[model samples]
Target: MIWVHLLIVLAAIFLGARYGSIAIGAAGGLGVILLGATGAPVSREDIPFDVIGIIMSVIAAIAAMQAAGGMDWLVALTDRLLRKKPKRITLLAPIVTYLLTLFAGTGHTAFAALPVITEVAKENDIRPSRPLSIAVVASQMAITASPISAAVVFMASVVEPLGVGYLTLLAIAIPSTFLATVATSFLANMLGKPLSSDPVYLERKEQGLIELRGAHEYEERPGAKRSVLIFLIAIIAVVTYAALISENLNIISDPTLPRTEAIMSIMLAAAMAITVLCRIDPSEILGMQTFRSGMSACVCVLGVAWLGTTFVSTHMEAITAFAGSALTAYPWLLAVVLFFAAALLYSQAATTKALMPTAIALGASPIAAIAAFPAVSALFVLPTYPTLLAAVEMDDTGSTRVGRAIFNHPFMIPGIVNIALAVGLGFLFGSLML
Candidate 1:
């Protein structure tokens, strides 16, 4: 029965991979139905509504900011910083994207920075793949560290009762992932041939196909800075509140609103504030690309997490019986498992909600789980991911092209290095901190 049920989960992932976008969530919903029809126990309690709520609220605030031109403001700032040190774009690009994701709580923000990274690399005659590869990976990994990201939020919930809180999780996740990303930049710098000497680039240049059309000058909108300031203040408020009420602090005991609920309220309030203060139309927020992408992500989390949690709940006993001892003995294997599952799940929040609870039940310690949390950023394994494909497409020099062998792409090596080193550093940090 477990094997049969596992096939259904795999089939859902396959359908998601084939169809793309919201189909991933729809396929997951179908998997849930299949599980119930096949006599597997299904429970409504398995649905991760809290995780969904957190993601939706965060997305709303971010979308509101985007509608007000705040994202453009941020990109323009990063662009200026990158141009100052063109020769170090490989090291700087990922750092820029990483910080963007950290603030926005979504890797999709990397799209706004990708064009700039490519242009900087091209201007310096450096291979665009060097910066682009690590930039995409860094953006993905940053979700685990982002204070408001659904993945980190869900992780804090699971670990809080076990003596780890939100701030503690950030303490371990941020430094570990950030430093690993910086180290991987060196590896990314050496990934492919120099832009001038690469055969594909040379051919493209000979064919007059290599156009170095730089990004346009970005004019700040009337309310862009104000919107960004409002959103940043909201984020600070969320973090400050969470820290005060955390188990470690116990400063706000028995509060009527729990941490998750507080986050939703604060973000929704921030969205309203942005709409009113920025004088932006509410409908325009709905039309923003970030809103559409984010809402779609909410659906994906809903369906995939529901499907995964249902299956895991029904087979909890069997799963624990089969893999519990091994995991208990080699806790690091938990990170390895999460790394591959994330590749299939295609969502850090969904993967965390689905697996972390079960890991805790099987005797995995809080530190072990926290150390492994960064592994869920392995969304680059397949080339079909939006940001990964965007990196490949935005590079006109042909230096960032994907190979016929799907795994042979430029992002693979750098992404793998980042995740591996992050997991290692996570353990080191977790041991020292917690």
Candidate 2:
């Protein structure tokens, strides 16, 4: 069953679904068949329907934001802010991307910021690849810092029973992850100069590929500033509400309040505010077509996750036993093991659900496991990530492939450093139980 799960994941990546629906469907079907054939207890109810809801809602909200041009507005704002200096642009790009990931709870937000970063990079004669790489790495790093992120949420649930406090774990993970992102951006900036001066960038420059042609049209809208102000306020409120709820002070209390509920509330509220301020219909903001399209995009992730869960549940005992023995012999290898597992799994939430419990059962400290969470969670930055593929397709630039080829350029280096720094910092700060 474990091998089946891995094979399904590999197939999904290789086959490359347009929206991930086919891959997910295939994986889910196979999981059910294999589980039943093995006489493992399987039921429809065992499926993580709540997770599916959360994924759908978040994707929908992002779609709504995009359709309403909210994303463009935000990008324009970022562009204005970073237009003064190349060095400032370099610093601000990663910081903004990281903040977006923290607030949006997904790397998609960071990817959305890429165009703005790339444009700024072009304007400044800086390598677009450097800022693009920074944006990608920043998003991955922020996944560990984002309390509302699926990875952090899943890890919190798994490690809480083992005596690790959520805030403490986040405290240890956030700074290290942030620093790793900054370090990656700096190093990439140094190395990417040569590549930026290569024929490709020069050709693109001659073709006017990187020029900001529509800046004036976008900035000319009358109420743009007011609409953007409202949007910013709404986002701030959403973040505050999420933090309050997580801290046990908000309206929602049920640990199982379904992450979707919180996210949807924010989405709806933001949509309403934007509509009222801009005098546009809410439905028009995120047309039925766009909503459906976003949902379709997430289907693959949902299916793959469900199938992966089923596969793990079916082979739980054997896999757990084997993992336990292995970890017992080399406990220090936990960070590396999780990093590789995450790279394979792609979905941090799914990876956490699959392996975290087993880590606890293996007598690993909650802190150790939680500290390792960032490493595994960062795997979503892989070029095969569904959101990443979409971003790559959107840009029509081979940056994603190029980025992947230069593994140390962005995702890989930052991911590795995040793990190493997080584990080391956790131990130094006494956040690690051992």
Candidate 3:
């Protein structure tokens, strides 16, 4: 029966991956129904309502910023930063991508910067693959670092009953992921040949496969800077409020509202402020690229989390027995297993919510789990992720590429390196902090 149920869940994931984002959620719902009919216990509380709220609120605020041209202004700034330091872009691009995901709470923000990094690197005779690969990895890694990110929010809640809190998780995630990105950037710099000397790029150049070059261009809307300033101010406020309320400081008194409420209200109110002050039409928020991508993420998280939670919760005994015995002997393998799972699930929130709870029940230490939190960013192990795909599309020089073999993409090394440093440092930091 357990094997049968597992097969159904896997089939749903396969269908979701095959059809694309929203299909995953639909398939998850179908799986839930199939499980219950087969006498597997299903609970309503298994749904990640808090994670959903966090994602919707953050994405709503991001969409509002996008509608107000804040994303454009930020992207335009990133373009200038890359062009001005083209020689150093291989190092700086990952930092830029990391910060973009850290603040924005979604790696999709890196889409705007991917082409610019590739182009700048190519023009400077640096291999575009170097920056493009690491930049994408940094972007995904930042999701674990972002305070309001669904993954972080979900992680905080999972470990909360064991005494971990929001800022504690952030403490472990931020510095670790940032350091990982830096290390990954250094190594990614050495990959492939200089753009002018590369066989692939040179052949493409000779074959006229290289697209015509132009300076990165984005027309700054009238209120772009103001909108960006307001959005950033809102982000600062969210982080500040989270810090005050989180376990790190415990400065804020118990309020009528939960931190999730604080986040939702702050983001919605900020969106309103941005809409009015930046002269953005509120309806336009729903039409922005960020808005659509965010909604799609919501569905993916919904389907995947629900399916994963249901399976783990229903089969807790079998899961606990197997995982507890194995993890007791080799605790660090938790991150290793999650890294591989994330490579398939391709979602930080979904993977964390689905598996972390079971790990906790299996006697996994909070500190160990916290230290290994960044391993969930391993989706870039495969080149199918959106940011990875976008990086490939943006590299007109043919330098950034998936090799002939399936797992031989340019992103593989950076993804592994970033996750490795993050997990290793997570253990180091988790010891000190937790």
Per-residue lDDT over 1-434 for candidate 3, one digit per residue giving the tens place of the 0 to 100 score: 78998998888877776676577778888888888888888887888877888888888888888887788778778888888888888799999989989988888898888877777776777788888888889999999989778888778888888888787788888999999889878898888877778787878888887764668668888777887787688888888888887766878768576777777788888888888898988889989877888888888888778888898888888877777978867778899979977876768998998898888878888887887788898988766788888888888787778887868988898888889889899999988987
- Each model's C-alpha lDDT? 0.91, 0.59, 0.83
The TM-score between candidate 2 and the true structure equals 0.78
Residue 288 C-alpha lDDT in model 1: 87
Q: Give the TM-score of candidate 1.
A: 0.98
Give, for candidate 1, the lowest lDDT window spanning 10 residues: 210-219
C-alpha displacement of 213 in model 3, angstroms?
3.2
**Candidate 1 wrong stretches, greater than 4 Å:** none
Model 2 weakest 10-residue run by lDDT: 395-404
Quality of model 3 by C-alpha lDDT: 0.83
lDDT of 1 by residue, 118-172 (tens): 9888888899999999999999999999998989998998998898889999999
In terms of lDDT, model 2 sits at 0.59
TM-score of 3: 0.95
The collision pairs in model 3 are none
> Could you tell me every candidate's TM-score relative to the true structure?
0.98, 0.78, 0.95
